[model samples]
Target: MKTESQLNIIFVPYLSPGHLNPMIDTARLFARHGVSVTIITTPANASTFQKAIDTDMNCGYNIRTQLVPFPTAQLGLPDGAENLKDGTSPEMLGKISYGMSMLKDPIELLFHDLQPDCLVTDLLYPWTVESAAKLGIPRLYYFSSSYFASCARHFIHEHKPHERLVSDTQKFSIPGLPHDIEMTTLQLEQWVRTKDEITDFMNAAYESESRSYGSLYNSFHELERDYEHLYKSTKGIKCWSVGPASSWANKSNEEKANRGHKEELAQEPQWLNWLNSKQNESVLYVNFGSLTRLSHAQIVEIAHGLENSGHSFIWVVRKKDENENGDRFLQEFEQRIKESNKGCIIWNWAPQLQILEHPATGGIVTHCGWNSILESVCAGLPMVTWPMFAEQFYNEKLLVDVLKIGVSVGAKENKFWASEGVDAVVGREKVSKAVVELMGKEESSEMRMRVRKLGDASKKSIDEGGTSYNNLMHLLDELKSLKASKALEKTNLKI
Candidate 1:
């Protein structure tokens, strides 16, 4: 074996906050377990989590970041526009995808040069399956979402239940899942509803997953044990549930605050002070994640809704342009709320984990992103689930119907964030009602209790001798044995 000390694994994270952050956290967790870990990404993308990696290295963990050139200029994108959050328009997003595709060859070459024992890459990079095979290494597909979503998608794709529906609003049951999950055609992504180029890409990705050695999920065994069972039995792949990775990796407030992006906001203290001023579990936190741009009308409705709900809130607003349509109205609303001391509007990029862990934060208004859901669950907070696109609707079902910890805002359409318009906007009344129920109502007490228990389970899952911890140890042993077996085969051939 070529191993000097321990098994070496390379993590290839996709270039986005939701995907990038947790993958980096998982890499750090692996490093903490005495594995040699290297994260390979473009320079601009690496800059987002470089500080966190540096901290791990300083702590004497065997972790490092390897940089590659981001083909921004070649793809006609502006410098530093290497992440999905950097793409302001559909055209720019296309350029970013094309640029990412251009890196496949260079990344494969690195795979050959590094000669790691295993390749753990984002689900987006389906091509890596072949690269890992060429290098005679195991490839573990990194799924950043829940196992419930994965099983739901698999059944939906296999059964084609949505295809039999008459209207987009008609509900149908997904077949062969452990839980009875129902979803309307409107809730599914456009690619699932119809055949397109994206559909082909997704199909290729899943096929690659099935062909790979195994998969890694950022989920815990207790959170979705039934769905986890269903996923493995049907897909017939070896997998590990080692997650709540954020909590396990960033154990302290300082590490949580500096988890992603190095920029220090001048208004950080203001928000922290605002959060500190509130009572325990008294404030609502609203964020639509790194993607998901709301229209001007939607922003105005959200503003009115939060104001009318009679709750203290800290909303992370991602304004497209200073002169955009709702700029004047948002400015006026911010001033009024500021003077009233009722709400705080953070311009962009709030410290999410820090805010969630704060004692003052009670509930969340989330776009049903998996990362956001896990973070909230870990914080023991219920949610007002507003699913916009992707597998979010499935996640919403897990929260509202299965978990019973979320109140849905009754969002009806599933449009991509960039393509969202006023047509699918949940009115201010719906928003206000959901928030009131999630934050103030007596029924919310039960929801809080259930989530708190789950939060405790999430913490225990990562401790020594826990399910996730044991799974990690087993996976490492398997990788090391495989490496030794390969070395024996080579020796036999030489003899």
Candidate 2:
């Protein structure tokens, strides 16, 4: 184990809102618990951090942020670089390499100057781990993902190296993963295939994780008990599940629009007003998360599916092109919606947290990213999971099969590569049936109650004396112990 030291914890993330949000919240929680924390992010994200700091400052937190220089290649990324139209594994590898190379020196200098007792960072950026090791800081991986997703990523790293590319048969079932959880080749990211770069990156990723001697996952152990054993046994690092972290991080003051960029970027009231008119558990909030995009055909298919389902819904469609004719497709969609006399509220820019928090939100049609999953769970809503790529398939499996908290879609066919922007079509009949089952059926109602109970437990865990809260305290004390040990070591060395 790394020796005790005063925890001057430094956290860094690869550029993305999803990665940045939870991490910033965790930092705040640490600061609240009396750990001196500094967040290193790009200038692009500094504003978001500033708002959060202001909010915390008002509530009396000392969490600080420093805008590190962004690597030149990272500066001009499209709105969603992770979901780029021309994304390839090789290209992503080069981008990550370049980003790390740019971030390392500045980060190392800061590590030396700040002299943090420990370092916590996102799993994707291996360079941070290398930097932490060089500085002799105890590094912890804060995976902003479910236990299932983490397990799958680990499985992908351990096996599938020589295979180069994942075949459909190859992902059927792994020896180490949970039963009935299917991971297909198409759902696997390109990072899984590149032998040299991916392996090297993953080795560093694991090494950093190993050095941490512990991890903080954004999930509860009860929800993932089966997989938790494997997680513990494999890494040999203490795993602390402290989530639905997103909800714990939520400011709860919808009135305070000054805390984050989401407030400026979205109109929370518009979503809430529509929800107010709807019945309890009557509306389904549809979104594919920030990183997933749909093609025209898939969009039409989803439109028709919602229309046929005869349910009211608030659909969030994030387009790369929000030009004058941005919502040109809505004209056709409205006609179909009018025929059914069902409600369809389309927002290119939707207030996700506010919408999820609304009482009318009974179900979520989601991309099963960890944040979206945690948000849905916190909202006490069930999911109609449409996992796109990467570790989402694993998250989807946990939701639908293991936890029975959501309905699963998107793995039966390989529509991801069929065309650009085209979602794998789950035709109107299947979509209608699934929604009907999720919204009106007895089975669906039971699942709704199940997730509600889970939500309550999540809240309890993060509240005073709850599992998550207690875990956070333990982690803080652990850092303190390290701090004391370091002081003692220096004293003995002088003797």
Q: Residue 346 deviation, candidate 1, in Å?
A: 0.7
Model 1 TM-score, all chains together: 0.97
Q: Taking the tens digit of each residue's C-alpha lDDT, what string does model 1 give over 1-495?
A: 224648899999999888999999999999998889989999988887888888888988889998889988888889999999898888999999888888898888888888899999999999999889888899999999989889898888888899887899999998987667888998998898878999999899878889899999999998898888888899999999989899999997777787786885454589999899999998999999988888777887899999999999999998773345578988999999999999999987888999999999999999999999999999999999999888899999999988889999998888876334666778899999999999985969999999999999998999999999899899999998998898889889999
The candidate 1 region of ten consecutive residues with least summed lDDT is 416-425
Candidate 2 residue lDDT tens string, 1-495: 122343678887656656767888788778777666789876656765577677677776667787775554444544333222223334563564466566777877888887888888887766666677777656778888877777777776677532553464455554477575656666666566434686576667766777665788878755677787888998788978777666787756552333335346455455566678788788888887655556566666777788778888878765552333436776667666655546655554565777777778889888777888887887788998877766677788788878898887544433333254334566667777777778885768789889998888877878889878887888888877876887788899999
Alpha-carbon TM-score of each model against the true structure: 0.97, 0.87
Name the lDDT value of residue 158 in candidate 1: 84
Candidate 1: residue 413 lDDT (0-100) = 84
**Candidate No. with top lDDT:** 1
Worst 10 residues of 2 by lDDT: 79-88
